[model samples]
Target chain A: MSPFILICVFVVAFLLGYRIISNVPSLLHTPLMSGMNALSGVIVLGALTATTLAGSPLSVLLGAVGVALAITNVFGGFDVTHKMLRMIEGKNRQKRARPELLDA
Target chain B: MDATAYNSIAGILTLAVLYGLHLMSSVKTAVRGNLVCALAMSAGIMMTMYKDHAFASPVLCTAIAVGMVFGLFLSNTVKMIQMPQLVAFLHGLGGGTAAFVGLVILLDIGVANAFERVSACLALAAGMITIAGSFVAAGKLHQLLPQKPLILPGHGILANAILAVMGAAFVMHAFALDTLALFAVFLLFTAGLAFGIVFTMRVGGADMPITISLLNSLGGTSSAIAGFAVGDPLLIAIGGIIGSSGFMLTRIMCRAMNRKLVSILLGESSVALGAQDPAASVSSAPIAPKPADGENKAASWLTCAGKVIIVPGYGMALAQAQHRIKQLADMLKGRGASVSYAIHPVAGRMPGHMNVLLAEASVEYEQLLEMDAANPLFAEADLVLVVGANDVVNPAAMEAKDTPIYGMPILRVDEAKRVIICNYDDKPGYAGVENSLYRRDGVILIQGDAASVLERLIAML
Candidate 1:
């Protein structure tokens, strides 16, 4: 396939993916985002593959750029997730605070 | 065919698998579990880069790994309430990275490519402004900066005019004007940054969530513009998603407060100042429940209640009592009682704050009802259990004329048969006004920690 075809395919895939993800109900967003953040890690692999195989300097540059963004997305996702976990864990402890008296 | 290429593909596949697993988990677990998935994904990405010249050397690999370890430590150590700030910081990082990419591209290739150069310049300006604006917003929310409004020497109109002039300078540079236009662009960027800070600072705490969402959208837009400059479709698509979602979230938050988008944007009418202080007046009313006899009777009557409404608030998020509250709700349901949650839009510091917390608790999406639907049910509810909620249930917002929350939509908990408020103290809400519902003759103020109080209430029931 031509380079132009490859670019077109990537663009179409991105557009379709975005459309499906964005249309999800608000209730599903957090979960969806969490999923996407994980999936976004794939971009790193794509970057690595593209960079390593690039016969041209431009492809290598673009691939390197892609790798950088994927890493950032992954780190950001983890940061958000950890915070959410702490929040839930804290709530559990707070509930156990006066457990003895309540059970009686 | 190269070993490096194979390794990169393997790394990417590993990350993808982890992400897919995270997506499939239950929402409650997913909220916390996604972090681990994200870490794995990031590690995979870094591994793939190991073959690149950037990471091929041992020195580079070590450096990258060290950075990753530090990020992991920070992500784990930071407290939950500070998460939003951390998220904003990450957004800034993303925007700055994209902006840097654009700049590097321009520097590497020179300015001969007009399309790429223009795109890069736009990205740089937008990204830099977003970074500064987000910091100001995060500072205000975190109380690092004062919540008071900061009006420039000239009001909004003048600030906007200046922004326009700066934009013109930027355009001139795009058309091959001398580097002098760059100076104007920088000046305009600084002014816009200040304008964002001043505009957000004046907004009341109730509107901080909206501001955060808006800034988040701006950050995404900057990234998309950067992607456009570099001819990256993935970046544009991802950025667009974030931008649109942020916008929708802001709109939802504004609707919840019954405030118009224009009003919030203008940064006026958020003062929340009232005629006389309700806080001082509430102190003198009565510490002991004056209607103790009635409260006892109501509590006893509710013992065998058939239906209950649980109203949540920012206090719930602060106390992190969502899971316990959900447990209590489940217990009520087991006893043949119908339990439903009443969520006010601006209930927490952000739009859908209560929803996010409740969703984390694995509460049924259907069981969680909006303010409008829940208000009508309160009248028929045998008991109304308010958990760390305030202001939203304040009848003054609905009835009184001389109050800050006046004319604001609120849950009609006042109309319920019996109102049981679980709060830490009789302190005023974020609005700095006492809740009149607390002073109402019928409401019962069960003063204690939200989770503990709910646990006891569950036992009592």
Candidate 2:
């Protein structure tokens, strides 16, 4: 990709993300942050590329570490975010199911 | 796959990720949104493996499996109160990956041009700083390190000196001084690490939300720059999105605290008041001890209250009293008193932290109100129950000038007809400003462990 195209892609993506994330209420900010953190771990793509294309064994070893770290970040972030959302959602579901109980 | 085909696939996956994020704006669809993003990530990984033929590498596969197990372990074990620490730790890992990628590219693949070199250098610097800074923040949150701000002599000057050295190294590498490239990388990495540690060490507990947000942004930006170096379109796109989200959250946190990002970054603690009367300090302020009949009076007030608002803060999380708080709310509701929770924007260690804790305790989302919405209802509230909270409800944020929390927004708990406080002590909050509400005649201060206090209150009622 050309530098100009890369800049355009970055700028457009950033603006779109800014606009969309603004709609997320502060009630979910923690989850939103962790979710975004997971997305940032897309650097695993770069890590994979580096590992495959490495000319030296040391480079490949370092690349493998990067891949592992990025993977942990991606999965850990998404997992925790999922757990939190479920916690909140499960409560809402229970309340919805037992409206009369709350009213009493 | 050819470049055009791969780019097209990347574009589609990027859109899929964005759509998933869009689904995250509401509570109802958020879980599905997370799943969508996860699936999209999986697809992206498969595509990369296919394009790069990385499946042939057994070492890489084993590493990935190990990482997945570790990730699941952390997610399964972390308590809600430890969420901030866990998030910070993950941010560090993400940053570490970007830094390693940058180092590998610089040392092995080699930069093709000044732009690529600059991007790689930037990635390394940003990633290093993020990894170091985030670990410091995590340490503080986890109580592994002291929460007090540690200011070194001439801290600002030392930080600047490190920056100057790193800048020189960056220029040297950008200019194709190939012989000194390794030296430049070393200098930049060490300088970045030093700056990160020095910058974060001076930030006290109250300013952690901003620090965490800022480090989160840096982590994402580092990955985005690393993408630029590797010419990965999908990495660039999603990394940009993550960077923007972190930046937006950082701004929200700063705005909520009515603080400038620069001041917080400079490690200015809560002690720097513009001008203040010593008598207004918590120590100097006269305390009206609770009467012998305080518990009876509190129970009577709770029973008679037609409208009640409860305010919670980090102290509540410390005391692990959210369950008891939920019970208190339920008990009040059972008595036919309408109870609502008032949440300040900066109430907890991180943005929306209290909401998560309350949700864990099964507090209905509808019953929790934001500061703006809750402030107006305080006037009509017959009683306000404060549970392990102080700074967010401190009237000094509004009434007292030149204090650390002055001009910052608060819950206006003092607006209610009567207030009952269950706190660990009568001390000022993280911002170190005396709570003027404690001095009010209508306020009934009950200082003890919040869980025990709420348990007693429940028993009395």
Q: Which stretches of model 2 miss by more than 4 angstroms? A: A99-104, B271-292
Give the residue spans of candidate 1 off by over 4 A.
Answer: A1-73, A78-104, B1-67, B102-109, B147-162, B175-178, B181-185, B273-304, B320-336, B355-367, B395-409, B423-436, B439-441, B446-461
Cα lDDT tens digits, model 2, B1-461, are: 99999999999998999899999999999999999999899899889989999888998898788778888888899999999898888889888889899889988988787678888899899889999999988998887887767778898889889889989989877764568888999988998898889988887655777888888888888888998998999998988888888888889888878888788676666554432422132224334545637777888889888899999987689889999999988998998989889988777778889999999999888788988889999998999999878877888888888777888888888888899998776877767777878879998888767788788888889
* Model 2 docking category: high
Q: Please give, for residues B1-461, the per-residue lDDT of candidate 1 as tens digits.
A: 36556435543543343343434344355454455545555555555455455556443344335445555665666554554555555555555455445444444433446665666677666766666766776675566876544555557676567567657756666664556645654654565555555566555456666776666666666665665564444444445545554555666666666678887666554445542332332223334533444445545655777888989886687668888888877777887889989888677655445766785786766677877778789889988888878778887787777766777788999888778887767877656666878878667787656776666655566
What DockQ does each prediction reach against the true complex? 0.16, 0.80
Evaluated with lDDT, which candidate comes out highest? 2
Q: Residue B199 error for model 2, in Å?
A: 1.4
Screening candidate 1 with a backbone cut-off below 3 angstroms (N, C-alpha, C), the clashing residue pairs are B149-B202
